[model samples]
Target: MSDDGDDPGRAGTGEPAPAEVGAKWARDRRNRVFLRRALAGVLVVAVVVVLGFSVRTSRLTDESGAFGPDLAPVMDRIAAENAEVEKNHPGAYVTVVAMFPMTGSLTDIGLNRESIRHGLEGIHLAQVWRNRQPSSPPYVRLLVGSDGPDDWEPTVEAIKARTADEHIVAVTGLGASTGTTRRTVESLSGSGYAMVSAVITSDELTGVRGLARVAALNSEQARAGVVHARKVNPGLKAVVIKDLNPADSYVKTLARFYTGSLADRERVMELSFDSSTRFSGTVLDVIAERVCNSGANTVLYAGRSEQLPALMQALSQRDRCVRPGMTVITGDDASEMNRKADLNMWGDTRIRLFYTALAHPAGLTLPGGEVLTAIRARFAGDDPDAFPRVFPHESLGDGMAIVHHDAMFVALETVKAFAREPDVPSPQDMANMLTSGTVAVEGASGPIRIVEGGARQTKEIPILQLNPDGTSAYSGRITMTDGGPGRS
Candidate 1:
């Protein structure tokens, strides 16, 4: 009777004794109290979570909704294509999870949602192409998994959970080159997944097991950028304006490599700023005063394009005592800047600005351009496969499509190269295949020559000049080999 843990049952047969009744009542009361506390705790947590993300989150839970409103059709197309590919190729198709920023501040910078749409569209085109290929067996099945750029740990776990059910062979299109991204790559790598990133450009990301990129590394871009900068600005006395955000791997490597690649006698005053500050407007103004006083003819801006306007504004309004027509060169983050920025609207004091392009449309001239042209034709419905059902041609201009296509192509090529018969290949098998030193992907950007070595896309890195007319002019092309920068 005193034992609350045991059953004091006999309710249907007869009335329980007073002690038994008291015991049952006490146990029931305790259970009710415990449940009530638990429910209250759960409610508290629910409110905290809602309040935490309410300001920042729009719809992170929706698979495609986070890409923005206009991209709903693109998401629908992906779903239809996903269904069609699995339907036609009725076998063990290998899955590749593309981890992109379905939600992030990428747009708060210079990037746009159309770029994300184009990337997914590119992946869809590749799926349709590969599934229909005569090569046969082991067609690709792409699963998108994004928990935003900053919070990828949860999605990594979710993807790991899906591996058995989804037959996931590899991961692709890893989002921005931040510390969070690096950790995700490392975690997925630890779990024996092959990760092919479309746009991860951190120099520090090299040599991580099962991690490869279809984009040029920051050092590669810097190496290529320096080759052009020296020729254009002869004296080349420069101020390196850099972002001090610890999480941003891209700008960190860009600043380091650009500084290292410069001539010993070429350095002037080096300036720094942390983009996280809301006070950038006033801060850049101070930096502008120092630049005017420093006698530097060029500004090697190692920051995202989000801060470009502030720098341009500050540079434009600076005292005319600074060397006129200063040249500003940056990394690949500037590739999409032209779409958001009105470069023509800036004052006359803002001179020439150059940035490295990861994969330019001009890459259509390369050997792989044959494949790119054929695939891109699908976007315009010029190809018989997509005729009268065109995806917008303008979406393909930003190179997201090309890089994302190349990322998927690299993953598929690894699968095809693995010598597997119509069965789900293990991620360890794909990881082994990638690191085996023979997986050369003929990327739409250019040939992705080295996956395991120091550089992934050791092909062409285009240097683009932001024009007064708000367009990018392909100023020059240089290649980055494991050996060094080479002629494209």
Candidate 2:
């Protein structure tokens, strides 16, 4: 058992332990193969993990760059705007009932119907031009109601039915007396729609909670007129007038203020014209000559535009003119005033006249060229009867179109305001917004701002005078002293 080279336990074959050596060699080879395979597998797993992380990072970067800060604000604004549009502009059907005098000589009043429809169409065009923006509800449908020549009863019924249906959002026209327009307005006041009048100038209409006016009130515009008259005739002392009615509110107010403005030492007389007596050219001429010869060079002719041509003709027959130190008259509408002053324009004398025009900046162009051209296009096939040469159809059409342009612009801005607010809007909501808030918008009429009380904030009345060459230009704007028209 203990022999070193060949003990008893060793038999002495001398072949040596080949089997044990072979087994040890096999064990070492197996360990090395296992290590190589494990290293290769780990390398493959690491490569896969790095590639996955890189792909995720790249995707996140792409997403951030595509929808970055620039897009966020725009998206937010659009969503906000659309939310309001959905609330307000639900159906694209807006019913508008237009009431006007359609009988008598005023059958032509409905002739202005084409004008109103064209105005709405123009407004809708402007909106469409705003890059296809979402529009407020009610794609303006107009319904016209007329009574024979000046009867407004039919208009009242139409308005009642329209409002009762709760489909109409706005009403326009009713161009009769203020009383009839008032009835139509009162019927719809509680329905939460707006009432817009074209030429009704009575002051009482403005007090209604839901009505707005495109034409200036005769009572309100009268203020600047008197102030202007005084500016021209600083020493103007008296107004000789034939009062149609002594108790007429218009006559009373005008007389009271005009007399009060003169120097205390000056004497102002109010002459009453006989109601039964129709004034003839010879009579008016005699009166003017007598008045001019008697010391008072300044006279205020307070009458209708129809009477102006006759009055002026009588004065001309007597060699009198509306120049300073002669006679002066103020008129309401441009067409009528320009018509009566037709012959006066042929001469070289300076004539001072005043009328209210829709205020606009010099050189501001409307959507269409020359407002008259646009208005006429609407009547292309409808009414071929052209206006008389003396009517100044271009000027009248331009003026009225400019007014409509301004009103439409205000309405759009109001709609935009509703579109931006968080609350949803109905027609009622829009009317309420107009009552409670104000908006400043650049428009065809001019830079317009609607005040909280629904009155246009600007009092920039246009003042034009005829120069020696008979051309007219803006002299200056007489700022309104108070809210009301001046007394003269």
Tell me, by lDDT, which candidate is best: 1
The residue pairs in collision within model 1 are none
Clashes of each: 0, 14
Report the Cα lDDT for residue 73, model 1.
Answer: 67
Q: Candidate 2 on 1-488: residue-level lDDT in tens? A: 00001112213766424233323433443454356557856765787788754211111111212223433332243234334433543333234444444344311231233333333333332332231322222223334445333455545545554452324555555453333345556666766666654445545455566565544544444555556666777765545444343322233343344454445544455544422245544455566566655565555554433344444444444443444435443423332333223345323243344444444322233343222333332223133222222122333232444455445545545544443232224556667766663555554444445556455554445555533232355544544424644322
- lDDT per residue (tens digit) for residues 1-488 in model 1: 11011233446777554344434443543455456657866766888788864222322222455455677665666666667756764443567777766666863223456666667767766666666654434556666666466557778887776675456788887776876677788899898888777888887888888876778888878877777778787888888888897778888899998888888788886789888777866888799779877878778888887778778767766656334767778888876665644345356535778888887766665443433445445444456444224464444446787788777877887776543232346888888777767777555675565544524746677787876455676776887777379875
**C-alpha lDDT of residue 400 in model 2:** 45
Q: Report the lDDT of model 2 for residue 222.
A: 52
Taken over the whole model, the C-alpha lDDT of each candidate is: 0.68, 0.43
How far off is residue 434 in model 1, in Å? Answer: 1.2
Tell me the lDDT of model 2 at 437. Answer: 38
Using TM-score as the measure, the top candidate is 1
